[model samples]
Target: MPEPATRIRPMGRRAVLTGGAAAILAAAGFTPAQAATGRSAGKATGEPTYTLTVMGTTDLHGNVFNWDYFGDKEFDDTQHDDIGLAKIATLVDAVRAERGRRNTLLIDAGDTIQGTPLAYYYARVEPITKQRIHPMAAAMNAIGFDAAALGNHEFNYGIPLLRTFEKQLDFPLLGANAVDQRTGQPAFAPYTVRTVRFEGARPLKVGILGLTNPGIAIWDKANVEGQMTFPGLVEQARVFVPRLRRAGADIVVVSAHSGADTSSSYGDALPYPENASTLLAEEVPGIDAVLVGHAHAEIPQRFVTNKETGAQVLLTEPSYWGRRLSLIDLDVRWSGRQGWQVVAKRSQVLKSNTVPEDTEIVALLKGDHDKVVTYVNSPVGTSKEAMSAATARYEDVPALDFVNFVQAKAVKDALAGTADAELPVLSIAAPFNRDAAIPAGQVSVRDVAGLYIYDNTLLAVRFTGAQLKDYLELSATYFKQVTGSGPFAPDDVTNAPTPTAPSGTPDYNYDVVSGLDAPLTYDIDITKAPGQRITGLAYGGAPVGADQVFALAVNNYRQSGGGNFPHVSTAEVIYNRQVEIRQLLIDWVSAAGEIDPVAFSSVDWRLVADGTPVVIEG
Candidate 1:
């Protein structure tokens, strides 16, 4: 969960792995001397047939309780409605039941510890007691996660909390790439080998090596920036493969918290596009298959060449947010002399169709689920005006502005007594869930929760006017600049955005900056380099130099330079303070009793040069 520098280019993307991955097919636990003589543990007498099924859930993002921020209600799908530890537990049981005991193993890739209001509420007010585990972890433990890995967001609560949670884990948390800062040894169990025997007396040893995306520095800087270091994922793989082999693993599987993009295949098999999950497959030797996540994309099956060893690679990813689950069925063999290798493999999706949620796991988590419901569904306040996110119908709706105003207030409050307490506080916010806009009229508890779905914490950092420009330029890359016309097509309904252009306006620059006197603008061409993305800059009302700094309040992800933004990563100072923005709004509005649309206005977006110019919409 750490990265090398400010560059968005993944240091792990090209990390090199070593050794012959093909050895799996020949020597999977078979003696190398025996394999050389064309003999395996049973090859001499008979062909050893073994089938292993791997069940994986990735990017649950703390959906342990059945609450939904989007619906402002319990997520009701079918069996008791919506996905939660209960439902996933049910689903996991059906999978194992269908597969039987000897043939199955269940694992989660990452983001298991953070992302819901329950986690938010628990972390802040309720002091941890051995009697009461964080509901999410408790549910996961009840559901019985066999092995799990760290996601970048897991570090949000900082290591102390994680270390506490770690004590309660029923299974090993495997991470091969993450090393201890003190000795560069694996911080957690680098990889775990579990033996499962579908048939016969002695079980086959299955090796699982977990690798989280090395973007930890980007999202968890507040809690984990300097405590540890991360090696290039590829480099770590090379070192670990040899160690895993020496450890007597029969079959090797990787649970990668990274993701895949639509990249072209290189020669035999290219690591499945844009995703290190696929890349991890090809690059690491002796790995039979990969369970992938972090992109939130749904991938059926992608075949790629091991970039490091030129061995074949297989990968699978179910979408994020509990939308899907990926299952891999693989045949493996072990040669006495060589090691373990893949014989055949396939992937299946964990959809509602034909799959019923497990009844038992659901029962185990219901108590925790009900507790969350009691709090989340309680009507703390009400609004008379109807609210919606239909952006096309209107711009800068009341609910939108309300979120910003409340967040700014929290930031200001959190910084009390600090030098920045009175400094011109700039609050940065983005609408993850938006539409036409929040309508004017009676608002329920569900209304506010629906608009802000992500369980994100508020963060503030000190940035220079120069660093601020660099950060803004990075955000600007999200917008697409229209050539002869404005940045956006007024009638373009799909929200489809152009990636790059002769003008090179990125369509993703969606930010709300609060409390600024003079408006601001960036005149530089984005087609230029990173440092030069800003051709011109302004403050309160004047041209600003690069050397100046400002106190910037942003979400945990942005403050860490997530989304490949520049300058945020290189800031000279970080306060390391965190405020749960979503809950703060919930808290603020609940305390306010009534809401007003008049409070939300922005000093963020400045005037443009194009006639009736449009900005690329995100």
Candidate 2:
């Protein structure tokens, strides 16, 4: 196993806090209590209070620069937010300067490796395991991170690559819950204790316990099924936080890759809730603050009181893609008998857009950025007409059809001369990016990649007609119920709130199913309730029989219990080539040399209310 690079060592009483010395002691066979006493301490003079600021970023998703590879331009949004570590470096420098460099600690929550084309290029095209340092590791090492929590997406490229990325970092990737399957012991370092020095008072020990989401068991089942298991965040924190306290930590802060909400996307597939950062705060007694992640929502500050201890725990989550940075400030007072105790705590999110890109980071990553830009812009094929997925959430469009077409074709081709070859193939796709579009004339890799944003692989499963109907019914819940249609807007009828998605169902969860060789048509009756919304289901102009079995082409995420979709997870998998769906689309376009949607496009589904076709304006 690779050792964590962030482990600090003791260098007398006036030693500066550079690494995880307590972890080094533990590695040297010292017990938790022994490690606590191993730290050098100074004689306390008076009750002096000091402020410690913890700066945090989460869900960076492979952004090193503000440029978007898919769009071939600098990233911009409705809020004019800036992205990437280059901009975050500027904000970090400003914070370190204002707070004094020695008093502040820099950390991250998770999702560091996979998102943009730069990450994909490194992970797949030229793997970092082949002796090349990952750009994320290089940039983060340059910025000097103390530690980071493990995210569920860290397993996207499998374990070997993850270990390589971990070794290249200057910080430890902490995960108390990610344990070995057989031993039931933590596979990674549970927590790290850092000593913050003071002149006249005793040094403050800050314990950072890293907790990862339990959904990794479901989302990355293929990569870690037999090797490891992920327990709940609250469950593992209960075991580690007390140990951290016993390790003589003056203050305990949790950097969790889970969200502040108590919702699970996988719905009972695992015994634990997916987003349990608040539960960790409310249930765990010793924690003083929490850095939340995974939900990608902005929360300046939230205080959850512990039910048993009556102490308030602070929580904050910076938005994803390095757009925001979380600033958590804690005040601690030193005493003769009791040592150090936290007096007050608060947190807020700082916008990276308010600052300029740090020239140091920009210059360091310029070569890697330019390589990805060139790769994505390289022409793959030509298109006969333009296609857009702006309104694909509520309407049938060729952009999504093109995705299903390529996926179903690939599955069918893979199953040729096999037992599943005779079965009819159906494909399912989701509108991942609302702004994804394919322009007329020559097409590039970025055009196809934008259509399928996730790093999902394709798989084929056998499902009965009844199970297929149930799947469609579950997907139909994405739309809100309506009476007589008066040309309602798409937004007014789409993204209905569900138990899993209390803040409206995301576009990725609203799947659109289509037939490969024939037209499979149906109507989602918005007038009806969920489970009864899917009506007029037919394949090849005839009603689908409940016992009819067909091969369904689906993504690995959906097949592996992502979004809690019905029937698919338990279905019998017929084909599993482990092929990435995005690469398939790009390869198909490259071989064909033209993207003429007329060859495979067909309107297979529509929205209706009381047997009347619903008109969706805009």
Candidate 3:
């Protein structure tokens, strides 16, 4: 809680000038004498100043300890960063001790449940609604959260589960944008006001507004479609910020489940951009700071100048999975006329690895953590041979083929007696985790779950051959253009960056398509530019006709425009059972008791330069 040094910059012409004569003198480029005199006058008048510290965490994703349920060990990254609420709790206590417990407030920007196996076990295996408390709830409540914004993933397990998780929380789970469809009113608490009291001074009222991403409408459409609606973040902030001011809040802070960047992965499916936290700060007045989430990026401090008022709003995102904590300190001054005003503010992110896990939190959730560990490690089936996804991004591999096979077969069997039964079934699978592997002789739930990391459910969409070709072309953009068939490392050719993905196309965005009963063969001619990479597309060893129809087994993320993939979002939905794809793979293996790649693996696709196949190494 030591005050970090901040570089000062001039505010815009329309900036809202606060904090008595000292701020006005500084803004007007007056001499030091004038500024000091203004400060002395304010002090002589007996005005009091205080620093309020707001600490926040986002995208916790069900982490309670610095443990990896999938790996059955302590979580470790290349950076050696520690994870979970246990570490965050230690950091929180340190901040509170330094800044005074009453002066510091702790809150979270959402994605509380559903990431690790612990969250899944509670949601699916032994549901918390069935007379049990969620580990996340227990950990967060123990840490004393003030409030939390609703993340899109909150609806992944449906509203009932989210409500149960909400009911168990000590603080409110707010979502101003998540509204009742019939009434168009907020479905959850839009904002909450907390008062910090002093012995001799008037109490300071801090208003916390919560706004969720608009993409929830597309991402969790099945869970919230008719029941609720998620409008744009900026739209709801405009309505609520003024209400907070009217409610006599001296400081306004926003816990936004949106990114600072103004971008959307779902294209124009929603009217608003998915990551609109900056826009919210700029367009909404009376907001002093914003705790951003959902992008999984680290932004220690970013100042967005409000267009209308020109007041600078501080924004910070603490990465994801409890890796970091965002701290915003507001320097406020009180006057007889204005109760309290934020005179100055700055933000910074604290690395969770710098501290050890809090013993209290570690002890509190040990039972839940152990249960998940035993569950993920329990053997479900056996594999004839080991399969790895390390090279699956640039080449066809049985590791991913097995996923496609399970998905395609499930869709085919589900539509056996339906009108779409005759349609050739194809399934799409992505190398979600490069380290994912199925070891020979044994396969556990974690093995399959690690391969398909997301909680996306399966859906079958009807697509014409022409549309399928276009979809393949879009996915082929993952690879960069290559000239010769020389040996090349996989990284040298795959994960080509585009406008949407500035860092590079993620493995999850590069899908591999395969057939259920036959091979869906194609050549990704990386020699050509994007939109022209897919070539020689065929099904059942025959060239697919433009009008030929087929059923494509796809995850809800892609089909609901998660990746901005073409055709699939607008295509007719032929089947949707709302069954999670990971669960399907687990069920398939448990029933079969064996994973034989020979039954479904095939060399269906390859990367080619012009007409010759490209040789990739490593």
Candidate 4:
């Protein structure tokens, strides 16, 4: 994903061969080392052989300070307690200790910020004191983050802020794809050659290049569109891989914030997560391995052979917000053309069940965590109706409406006096906090946080009628006709293909949009193209315009594209502010007690043309 913003797969907990994943680690033929840990890289090495232990995280989504919102006082999810930076730091230190100094490198693929409440709090109020430092960066700096790359979410705060972090960060931020809005220089260093000299012998040069999905223009239009341009992710990787080799990089590892979507098509075009066509290690001369992120899902296999190259490409992604840390051990054999070629690789999962919590780091983030406690748990306005995020599997939902209501209101609240306030606000909401239906009952602050576990702000993006069609096309990716009736059958993204098993199973794949009146239907064949599925669309009893400009609201992630919607890529943000929608939900609850159930039916669709399924625009 060369786009400034970043993007996932559907992965959840299953019975772990847990110990084998941790205790019985395999590296070519070596016996597993005892558990202790804890760690980026790319290229054709031209120098010497070396083994670089790569430890990585994707979609940390600002879980740096642990989670104050999901505290014991709120609920007993336990997902947060053992899954924050403090715990990750402990594991990282131990891993490095075993590998020894200079042999280990810590890198992040992308999506590091904007998840937990502490991150939101720090972004707005915290001071960078001698002791009270910027916790997220402070923790990364403390944990010895060797390098990191950007995610689309990074732009949610805008380029000025991103540059500020880039300038102040202690670790080098590398990226081959991110071009500066002003100078066209690589936004961060394109790549960095890290030299590790053990026993003062010849130093081993490891070249690390980072790539972010280039779709940032659509997601963060206000922050990046005019200021920057993404040349192209795959093409950029093609150009940079060789450049690293020429620069004398012994071992190369790519920290890609991009992704390969499970979806095959969008509108009439192929929807790719990052550089879908590019498989660098297999296609390029000197490249060895790649660490991927932005999908926020964990992939455990050591190697997924590239079909095109017969080259074994090693890829790893951990769960977002500190739920998991991925460790990849690369067995590098020295070569001449490329100094060190990673001949073998293996990965492990550091989960809460296997690893105990690191108490010290918890204490460090406690005060900041306390502030987080006050922010989310503290009562805001109340709701007279029950605003439960509870909904059934694969169904149009009210919780989504709840999410939309709060987010839209938050944007309106943030932009109350600005000229942009005149524009109608629409929020794009998704179900990250999916669970079996919420029993009609009292909703706590933590519960609201759970409704949208990812800490995201509200943003308003401007889109023309045509752009809206593209956006819907992207949304349609989640829905596919099961009849094989040319995939043109009626569909909703939330439903499971197979009916419920005897196990009374659940499917959490659905996403919902709210704020517009609807009686919408997509009767046309969608899979044929964008205009196909949307057989019918209207907002408030009227056909949508080809030229109408919409004031659309979305949580920072989707606006930044966690779901891969189209035209959303061209979002010209009319409302760009730092108001968290979760807090808005708390306010909504206090004002009304509970939300009366509200359904966010589809309100718009693409027009079919001549049975060819063409979606027309202004």
lDDT per residue (tens digit) for residues 298-335 in model 1 = 78677778765776667888776565657677766655
Q: Decide which is better by TM-score, 3 or 4.
A: 3
On a 0 to 1 TM-score scale, where does candidate 1 land against the true structure?
0.77
- For residues 427-464, what per-residue lDDT tens digits would candidate 3 score against the true structure? 99999999899999989999878888888999999999
Alpha carbon deviation, residue 85, candidate 3 (Å): 0.3
**Clashing residue pairs, backbone N/CA/C < 3 A, model 3:** 488-617
- Ten-residue segment with the worst summed lDDT in candidate 3? 3-12
Q: Deviation in angstroms for 9 in model 2?
A: 8.3
TM-score of 2: 0.93
> What is the descending lDDT order?
2, 3, 1, 4
Candidate 2 lDDT, 1-618, residue by residue in tens: 332232452321121222233332222222332111111333354455677888899999999998888889989999988899987776666555545566778889999999999999999988886468899998888887888999989999998889889888867789999998888888888888777775555767888999998988888778899999999999899988998887878888899999998988888888999999999999989999999999999988899999999999999999999988888888777676777877667777777775667777778888888888889999999999999999899889999999999999998998999988999999999999998999999999999899999999999999999999999999989998888864998888999998888899999999999999998999989989889998899999999999999999999899989999998999999998878999999999999999999998888899988888899886
Model 2 segments more than 4 A misplaced: 1-6, 9-46
The parts of candidate 4 lying over 4 Å away from their true place are 1-50, 65-82, 125-132, 260-278, 304-313, 332-352, 392-399, 402-429, 435-493, 496-618
- Arrange candidates by TM-score, descending: 2, 3, 1, 4
Per-residue lDDT value at 492 in model 1: 37
In candidate 4, what are the lDDT values of residues 5-45, reduced to their tens digit? 21111111122232333232231122355222222122444
**CA lDDT scores, all candidates in order:** 0.58, 0.85, 0.85, 0.57
User: Looking at model 1, which ten-residue stretch has the lowest summed lDDT?
Assistant: 7-16
